[model samples]
Target: MAGQAGRSAGFNKEDLSSYEYKKILCKKDEIKTLEDKTSHVSDYELCEETVNDFYTKFRTNHDTLKLKCDNENGSKCCRDVNYYLDHATGIFKSSILNDSDKNKLIKIVEEIWEPNLRAKDIYICERQTDLDSTRKRSILQHLHDLKEDEDYILSYTKDYNNHLKEKWEKIISYTDSKPSSLFVKIENNSMGIVENYKNFLDSSDYICGNNLNDLSAHDIKISTDMDDFLTTISLDKISLNVEKNLCFNKRYVDMLKYKASNLQRINNALSIGVAVLGVLLIFIFLYEFSPLGRFLRRRTKKQIEVDENANDEIPDSYENSENGIPYISYHSTSH
Candidate 1:
C-alpha cells in the first residue's frame, strides 16, 4: 500500500493544473493587451486562417510546383504545414513581446515572407567540373552566409534546382561517348570509336513511333509530320535486294573502316620493328672487330676467290706449248 501511494504521489494531477493556471493567466493578460491596442478592429482571423489564405494564393499562382511537390509527398505536406508554422511561432513570440502590439508586427511578417526570400541573396551549389577551387570556395562561403542568417528556404530551393540541373546535364552528357581508355585496363589501342550520329539515329525510333496524327495541329505536329514525310519510303518499294544492298553497303563501309584501323596498327608495328632493327644493326656495326666478324670476313674472302677462279678459264682462242704456252689466237677446226 505504501509503494502504491509513492507511485500515486509521482502522478500528481495538481502539478499540471498549477502550470495550466499560470499559462492561462499569462495568455489572458496578453490577449487583453492585444485587443486594446488594436481597438480599431473588432476581431482578427486566427493564425491558422491567415496561413491557410497565404498557402491557397501560393498554390493558385504556382500550380505546377504544387502538383510536383504533392506528387513527391514533400509538396503535399505544405497544405497542412501552414498552421504549424504560424501557430507555433506566433504563440511563442506573442508571449515574449515587450507589449502585445509588437506581436502584431511579428505576425505581419508572413505577408512579406516570399518577397523577402526573393530579395535575399540566393546561393546555388551546382556541381560544375569547370569550377575552380576559388569559385567553389566562394559558393561555399555564400551558402554558409545564407544558412547562418536562417535564410535556408531559398538556399534549399536553389540546391534542389542545382541538383536537378546536374542530373539532367549528366543525362545529356551521356549522349557524348565515354572512352574506357581512362581506366588503364582499356588501352588506347583497344578503345572503340563511337559515332556521333549513333545516339541521334537510335533516338529517331522513339521520336517517330508516337502518333503525331492524334495531336492537334501545332508546332510539334507540323515538325513530326515533316520528319515522317521525309523518312516514309514505301514498304512495297523496299525489296529484299534493296535491303541486301544497304546491308552490303554498311558492311563494306565497316570493312573499310576496319581495314583503315588495321593499316594504322600495322604501320605502328612496322615503325617499332624498324626502330628495333636499327638498334640491332648499330650494335652489330660497332662490334665489327669481334671474333664473329673476323670469321665472316674470312669466309667472304674465300668465296670471292672461288668465284673469280670459276670465271678465269681460258677461251678456245688460247693455244698450248710443250711446258708452258703463251696465249695466241687460233680459230682452226680439225675435220
Candidate 2:
C-alpha cells in the first residue's frame, strides 16, 4: 500500500491538477509518435512531398524576385539547380555537409527520381514474348510479392477486360518474329524504358498484362451513329506515371495550369545583389573624376623622384649620373 501511494504521488507532486497530468501524458505520447515517424527514414512519398513543397516556396520567391528586382544577365539562374546543389543555402552561409553526406543526399534524390526515369523507359516496353524461365520467373515473382487475395491476382493475370483473353494467348505463346528488349519491374514504380507503338502493334494484351500499359493503347469505343469517337484508357497508370515523370516528354501536351499562391516572404534580399553591382559599376565608371581617385592614381612622378633619391648615394647609379640616361654605361674617378 505504501509503495502504491509513492508511485501515485510521483506524478501528482504537490497535488498536481488533472489537466497538468493529462498534458504531460499527451506530451509523452507526442514524443513517441515523433520517434515512430522518424523510424521510417526511407519514406519516399514524404521525402518527395517535402522537396516539392520546398521547391514551390523557391519558385514563388523566384517569381517575386523577378518582378521586384531588376538586374540584367540571368538573375533568373539564381535558384537554377541544373547539375549541382543548394544555391539557396547562402542564407546559412555555413555548411557542415561533407562529401559522403552530399553523396547520400544525391542518392536519395535519385531514388525519388528513379521511377520517373523508369517510366520513360517503360513506354518503349514491347512485350518480350520469348519467355524463358527468366521472364516467367520475373512476372511470377512480382505477382507473388504483392500480398493480395486470389481474386486480386486473378484480376490482373486473367483479364480486367474479359475481351483480352483471346488475342493475349496468341501474343503470350507465339513464335518470336521480333522480341522486345525492354523489361518492366514496377516494384512500387521504380523500373522500365521508352520506344514503342510499332512493336506491340497486334499484341495490346501482353502490354497491358504487365499491370501497366506503356507501348500500346488497349481501348477504343465508337458510337452507334459512327459520328462519335471515344477512347477509354486506364488513367490511373497514366496519372501516376505523369507524377513520377513530371511530364518530361509531354510538357506542352498538358501545359495549361491554374494555381493559388499566397507567397509572401517578409525579408528583402531580392535587390541586394543587383543594387550592389549597379552601385559598384557606377562608382567604377565615374571613379577617375572623383576626389578619391587622386589618392588611387599611379603616382608616376612621385615614384620617379623616389627612384632618383634612392640612387643619389650610389655614384655608379644611372639615375644620379650627369645625363640621367637609363641603361647608359659611364666611368668616373673619385678623389
Q: Tell me, by TM-score, which candidate is best.
A: 1
- lDDT (Cα atoms) of all candidates against the true structure: 0.32, 0.30
What lDDT would candidate 1 get against the real structure? 0.32
Q: Against the true structure, whose lDDT is highest?
A: 1
Rate residue 281 of model 1 by lDDT. Answer: 93
Compose the digit string of candidate 1's lDDT tens values, residues 249-321.
2322353455567668999999999999999997798559678788888899999999887767554345555
Location of the lowest summed lDDT over 10 successive residues in candidate 1: 181-190
Question: Model 2 lDDT vs. the true structure?
Answer: 0.30
Off by over 4 Å in 1: 1-264, 271-287, 316-335
lDDT of 2 by residue, 150-238 (tens): 33334434232222222122222222224443322222231222222112222222222233223122122212221121121222343
